[model samples]
Target chain A: MPYRFLEDVAIADVAFEAEGRTLPEVFEASALALTEVMVDLDGLSPVLSREITLTAEDLETLLFRWLAELIYLKDSACLLFCRFQIAIREGTEWELQATVWGEGIDYGKLPLKLDVKAVTYHLFVIEQIPAGWRARVVLDI
Target chain B: MEAKKIAEGIWEVPRTAKEGMLVPARIYATDKLFKEMDQGVFEQVTNVACLPGIQKYAICMPDGHWGYGFPIGGVAAMDTKTGVISPGGIGFDINCGMRLIRTNLIEAEVKPKLRDLIDRLFHAVPCGVGTKGFLKLKEDEFREIMVQGAQGIIRRGYGWPEDAERMEDAGRIPGADPAKVSPKATSRGIHQLGTLGSGNHYLEIQVVYPGNVYDADAAKAMGIDRDFQVVVMFHCGSRGFGHQVGTDYLDLFGPAMKRYGITIRDRELACAPFASPEGQDYFKAMVCAANSAFANRQMVTHRIREVFSDVFKRDARDLGLDIVYDVTHNIAKIERYQVNGEEKELLVHRKGATRSFPPGHPELAERYRATGQPVIIGGSMETGSYLLIGTAKAMEESFGSTCHGSGRTMSRTAAKKKVHGRDLLQRMEQKGIYVRAASFAGVAEEAGMAYKDISDVVEAVETLGISKKVVRLQPIGNIKG
Candidate 1:
């Protein structure tokens, strides 16, 4: 599974765990987990695309900024992204470039169930497990 | 971490409870309330006490729960000269606050029209996830609001000038430099004025229940003269504008911590010295968010007045829709408090806690100086809320702060799993409470069982003499986002 909801992690917020074999795949799964909190991902259509690029000092901060950028797009651009194509590179600094695909929300057809306010660092973890790379994030809803 | 009872409703976690704790941690809670608290609260509270230049003790209210760095309902004051300021201390939704509006009409007069009133109010205020607001301001106009706060909207005919007097900080805090706010935050906030953001934000129609008025004179001063008198209460904050400000600062402060030589237990508790350039910049930006929230609430209040007039077929003024008070729950303010019998200036951060200034405090407006600042506590949709007044004891003990609301006891996902939204709706209907939410899952997540009892929390504060109850207002109808 790309992502699974983690129960009982927060009193008023929601938590989820995402995994992939590579850093970019984990980033994609994390992005999908975020949108799934707002709406049913299966019902969403990727009708448009927007490119995004973010750089951070480390992989963890990179993930934080990546998720925050997606939330900002939803709030300012009024778009709900369902698919994420991410590429990560580590050199002098950690950098992420991605193209997110989604459509303007049709409220009548795909009503939002929750408003994920911000991705929090509480108990956030990213590591390489035996099976693959895994990341856990808690969202302030 | 362990706590020992220090007083009737107080518990103390000694400085030795954790390494590097500069001060002891205190919590105001009954045994029952303490049992319901999460273990993370113990860790977070102690971590707050470990911050540099922390004065006295790090305190948590009766409704304290687990949060990112500071536990929700946490209160801490730091020395302005040497202490550090953390963006996490004030939540992402900066100045997330409460405003209570009182009406002359009573419950009996409103029962027949409750449905129409709630429906009209719901449509009047834009809510829910990914929702835009009514006002789309130009860059200059948005910056004006960031600087001027509610005064900007009041000048535009959104509210009366007198309304500003009843608001905390007169609806504006000084030192709000619009230039300190990032362009991205401004864009997110431009079209979000007068909007109610989702997740625990709501507009509720309530009635002062019979025999629930604890202080008749105080109640009367708040425009609650008779039993079952109608009122409206809203819980919201600065929206995406505030969130972006926090996000930007957290990124800035996290790296600045190493430069300041501050060792923090949690990454979320990132900070810089108060006198440092980075710290001063964050404070200025925070004030901008706080002021913007004041304006946001003022605009919403104006929309509510318009909706009431339309539903009652009378002018809003004639309907007697007036603001009782507006109080911010999440914010940091510079205030003077007595430390070691000498008055000193300190930066007070109250996250998920409300300021409850006692009677005769300089902060109270002329009309409310004798009655004390009104402390509004919102309950769950199924339970009732309270109207409280600040007390002098709170000034001495908690720096004039008290519990914000009934804190969550269960996780949102757990609540959703336990209660079906349709079933919760039916249960509320049977209890004569009308709830309108954008999504059924939203209702399920906020089910009454998910939170602790407001009465228990209020009783603890009352027993501690931090705040006094004036009236109990039960919800008749609610609009949730």
Candidate 2:
């Protein structure tokens, strides 16, 4: 299923396992779904630009931390992202590079719907489907 | 997720249920409300059961939730002789609570002027994050407010004298040593007294509906009166002062607990032995937070009277805004309760539970002895709220406590993801009550759907005979933080 809002939680349908793919593709799909929660990719012009790179233990922790930091940016900067080109460098830890962009927050209008107070321990992966990975998150607003 | 009856109207969490548990857990809820618990909530609550110095049981009222450390609806009493006090048990926002201010006027004269009165309150009262309050105090003055609690403010004449008398612990918790508080905590508190901080905190205008009791004459004596009866209800807490205390203490206790040999199941559950210096310090600081909260609400009461006087075109004396009661949500205190029919002096930590002391309890104020401690549970700004009195069953069954409010059912993120802020505003307006908020995100995050049915939560406690309904108040207007 494509990324969409469910109840009050944000959910996504993506192909984590596309018949045999590298770890990078799966990681990229998760980021795509996460950014979808903050801003509308189709409408986001990417007029602004920046780079976020992280080195972490392995694939899963790296993705989790990336999503968390991404959320932090959404909260602190009010900027969302779209369209990612990714590559992974493996050494002691995994390395990540990506571009994140969005427009300035208009305080006059309340565009931000929820206040994600914190990412909770309730996060978990159900399983990998033929298309990709499907996950559910209940943020503390 | 559902509650299993360990006894009649008393539920128990068997010791063998979960790992890392130091003690069992207990719950008090009606069969209907018991069913609302999801599996995750049960697990989290049981996790709290495993903490050190957790004397009797990790307990919860009907309104439980998945939260940082202890479940939002959790209640635990640790033995002072060998117990621990955890910040997670008290939560980040210390003493977040509700206060009720009553008036001398009946429904007829004030109901017509309610809107104008609310507008005045909305403008006069400071709300939302970073919103400054009416009274400004310096660092030393803030320290005084910390020690005296609401009395410090009332002595300065911000609110009525009756406010301190009617509130829990007389508008201040004893043993609050302001000296234990940090400079940062004092700085944060200087400007926040009497301010309504955000997140479910609100000042609501209400009319007293029938107590739904048969004795009409008796109801009047109890302040229930009749239909269309008007009143005002607000919920708030110690602002930056309380937040800072919790933050500072959590930092203080994080390492102190290890020194005291306290092993927590989670980092957030760090605790110190009750007899230890760290424990004593946290208690003293917590009292300061509780007092600050009492003063914060008292200041709002002062503003309410001022607004009502202006709107009604009458002298302030003519418009009575009496203090019903004010109770804390996130604080730990030392109290005595019966364990196996023997009195035990224990530190009863009520994170989200209200102290529902029955009429006979000696801790109650003189005036409330006949009616018991009034339990003010404020629902969402849009739906409504409730006024209840304590039952002896609550004291004997669940550490002399009951549910606080409608616990959050869905996260703000999920709620925001589902409902548009603009649309939510329209829906609330159509309901006949007007809401003025600080930010659009504030309103969306606090939408009524974010919480469970308060009526259900109340019904659980009532059916179990822990708390009895005294009156049901529907909102007329509200000022959100």
Q: Write the per-residue lDDT of candidate 2 for residues B1-481, one digit (tens) a residue.
A: 3345876455777778876778777766666556655455577678788876676678877777666567778898888888888877887567888887666666577667656776788778866534567787877787777788889989998876766778888987778888898776776567767777666677888776554343344345445655766677888777766766765676567558658776766555767888889888888888888888888888888888888887877876666566777888777878888887788888888878898889878998887887788888888767788888888988777788889998877765566677876788778778777777765666777787777788888888888788888777788677876
Per residue, candidate 1 scores C-alpha lDDT tens digits across B304-373 of 9999998899998888899999999999999999988989889999999999999999878898999999
Q: Alpha carbon lDDT of residue B467, candidate 1? A: 98
TM-score, chain B, model 1, is 0.99
Candidate 1: residue B9 lDDT (0-100):
94
Error of 1 at A87 (Å): 0.5
Which sections of candidate 2 miss by over 4 Å? A1-141, B1-3, B8-10, B105-112, B211-222
Q: Please list the residue runs of candidate 1 whose C-alpha ends up more than 4 Å from where it truly belongs after superposition.
A: none
Worst 10 residues of 2 chain B by lDDT: B212-221
Deviation (Å) of B119 in candidate 1 = 1.3
Assign candidate 2 its CAPRI class: incorrect
TM-score of each: 0.99, 0.79
Candidate 2 on A2-118: residue-level lDDT in tens?
433444222101112111144556555555555444334465555676688987765544655566555545533445666556677889888888766555544343233222222
